[model samples]
Target chain A: MNFPSKLIEDAVNEISRLPGIGKKTALRLALHLLKQKESVSESLSQAILKMRTEVKYCAVCHNISDAEICGICASNKRDRSIICVVEEIPDVLAIENTAQYNGLYHVLGGVISPMHGVGPDELKIASLMKRIEEADAGVKEVILALPATMEGDTTSFYVTRLLSARGVKVSTIARGIPIGGELEYTDEVTLGRSILTRVNYSAE
Target chain B: MNFPSKLIEDAVNEISRLPGIGKKTALRLALHLLKQKESVSESLSQAILKMRTEVKYCAVCHNISDAEICGICASNKRDRSIICVVEEIPDVLAIENTAQYNGLYHVLGGVISPMHGVGPDELKIASLMKRIEEADAGVKEVILALPATMEGDTTSFYVTRLLSARGVKVSTIARGIPIGGELEYTDEVTLGRSILTRVNYSAE
Candidate 1:
C-alpha cells in the first residue's frame, strides 16, 4: 500500500520487522501510536533504546539483567543447590510465575539446533558447566526445563550426559497430557507416553 | 510477570500500553528485540520518534502528509470535483488499494461517539466544510465511506445533511454481502439487504 507520509511508511516498515507482526498489523499499530499522546511514543522509543543499549547479561546465568549478577542469582531466598536450565529469559519468567520452584536459573540463550548453525559451543553451555563445576558453588541437582521440541531434547541429552559423569543428579520437567487437557483431543504420542508414565493414584 | 531486569520491565510496560497488546506478547516482543542486532531497535526507536514528532497533516484534506497538502489533494490527475470522506488514514489506504476510485479524500480522523466524548467539533469536520465552500474546489459530490456502525451512520447523516444544503450530491458506498462470501454463512441483515438491492442480471 502507498503510504501518505514517508514517516508512516518508515514506522510501519520497522514495526513489521518484528516477529509475528505483518504489514497490516504494523500499520494499525503505527496509526494507534499516532492517535496517542506524544509522551507515549517518546517513552516507548526511549524505553526500547535504553533496554537494547544498556541491558547486560548475568555473569553467572547469562540471563538478561541490569547488572552483572541477576536478581535470582543474588537472592539468598533461592536454593543454590538446584539450578533450572532454560532456553531464554522468558522461560525464567514463566517458571517464576508458577511460584513453585525456588531455585537459580541458567539461561542457555538458545538450544542446540544444527539447522540454525547453533551448536552447544555457540550457547552458554560452557558457563553452565563452569558454574556446576565450581567446588564452592554447592550445586547438586540440575533441572532441564527446555521445550519439548527435538532441539530441546538434544540439548537436554547432551547436558545431562555431561552432568551425570560429574556425579550431579540431572532431571527434566515431566511431559504428558496437560492437566486440563481432554484425552480425546490429546495427540497420540503424548497420550500414549502419559499412560505409560502414569503413577499410582490413591483417591482420598 | 516479574521481569529479570528493570530495563526489560520498562520496555514491556511501554509496549503493552499499545492497543490489543497484552503483557505476555509485550514480553515476547521485548525479548525478540533483545535477541536482535542493536541496529534493529535503534532504527525502530528513531522511526517512531521521528514519525510522532515530525509528521504533518494535509492542510486541505487533513490526511497525514509530509507537506502542506497531501499528494492526492494536490495531484491534477485526481477528481477534485468528488470527495470520498473517511474516518481515518487507514480507510483512505483501503480504498486506494482497490485502485477503483479517482477522487480525493477527506479524513475526519475519527467518528462521532458520544460515549467516548467525541463530538463533531472534535473532528476535522469544519475543515471539510471549508474545503467544500471554496469557490475553486468545484466539489459536486461527497461520498461518505465511513464504517457501517451506528457512529459511522450518525456522522454520515450529519455530514450529508449539511452538504445537501450546499447543492452537493451525497452518497454512500454500497452495503451487501462481500464478494466471494458464501450465501449460507452470510448474516441475516446483509443477506436481506443484498436481496433487496439485487440488480437485474443479463446473460450474454
Candidate 2:
C-alpha cells in the first residue's frame, strides 16, 4: 500500500513484524495511535522498551521475571515439593490462571522436535534435573504439563525417564474430554484415552 | 491473567489499549517480542515513538504527510480539475491502490455523525470549498466517495449542497454489487440501486 507518510510506513512495517499481525492490522493500529493522544504512544513505546531491555528471566525456572528468581519459585506458600514442567512461559501463565495447581513451575523453553532442529539439549532439561537433584530443595514429584502432541509426549517421556532414575515420582496431567465437551463430537483418540483412564466413582 | 513479570504486565496493558487487541492477544504479542532479539523490540518502539512524535499533516487536504503539502497534492501529474472526497486517510490510500482514478483527494477527517457529536464544522469541508474557490486550481468536480451509512450520506448531501451553490458539479461513487459478489446473496438495497442506476453496456 502507498503510505501518505514515511513515518507511518516505518511504524506499520515495524508493527507487522510481530507474529499474527499483518500489514493491514499494523496500519490500523498506527492510525489508531495517531488519532489518540501523543502520551498514549509515548507510554506504549516506553513500556515495550523497558520490558525488552530490563526484563529478567528466573534463574531457577527460566520464567520471565523482574528478579533473579521468579515469584512462584521464591514463594514459601507454594508447593515446593512438586514442580509443574511446561513447554514455554505462556503455558506457565495459562496454568497459573487456572488456579488449580499450587506447585511451582519450570519453563522448559520448548519440547524436543527434531523436525525443528530442537532437541532435549536445546531446552532447559538440564536445569530441571539440577533443580530436582538439589539436596535441600526436597523436590519429590515432577509433573509434565506439555501439550498433547507427539513432541510433547516425547519430552514428557524423556523427562520422566531422567527424573525416575534420580529417585523422583514422575506424572503427567490427565488426558480427558474437556469439561463442557460432548461425547458425540469428541475426537476418537481423546475419547479412547478418557475411557481407558476412567476413575472410580468418588463423591468430592 | 497473572503475568510472570511487571514489565510484561505493563507492556501487555499498553498494547491491549490498541483497537481490536485483547488482554490474551496482548500477552501473546508481548511474549513473542520477549522471545525475539532485544534489538527487534528496540526498533519497534523507536519506530512507534518516531511516527507519533514526528508525523505531519497535509495543509491542503488534512491527510497525513511528511511535509506541509502531501505528495498527492503536490504532484503536478495528478488531475487538478477533479477532487475525490473521502471520510478518512485510509480511504485515500484504498482509492490510490485501485489505480483507477488520477484525481486529487480531500480527506474530511470523518463523516458527520450527530450521535458521535461530529458535524460539518468538525470536518475539512470549509477547506475543500476554499480549494475549489481558488482562482487557479480550476477544480470543477467533487466526487463523494463516503460510505453508504446514514452519516456518510448526510455528509455527502451537505457537501454536495454547498458545492452545487458554487456552480461545481457534485457526484457520488456508484452503489452496486461488489465485483466478485453473487447476485443471489446480494443485499436488497444495493441490488435495487444497482438495477436502478444500470449503465449502458460498452463493448470495450
RMSD of each: 2.4, 1.4
Q: Mark the regions of model 1 whose C-alpha exceeds 4 Å error after superposition.
A: A200-204, B200-204
Candidate 1 TM-score over all chains jointly: 0.93
Task: Please write out the lDDT profile of model 2 over residues A86-191, one tens digit for every residue.
Answer: 9999899889989999998999999999999999999999999888878386987889999999999999999988988888998899999999999999999999
Model 2 segments more than 4 A misplaced:
A202-204, B202-204
True-contact fraction in model 2 equals 0.95
lDDT of 1 by residue, B1-204 (tens): 888899999999999998889999999999999889999999999999999998988988888998899989889999889999999889999999999999999999899999999999999998899988883958889999999999999999999988998889999999998999999999998899889988778942
Q: Number of the top candidate by TM-score?
A: 2
Give the Cα error of residue A129 in candidate 1, in Å.
Answer: 1.9
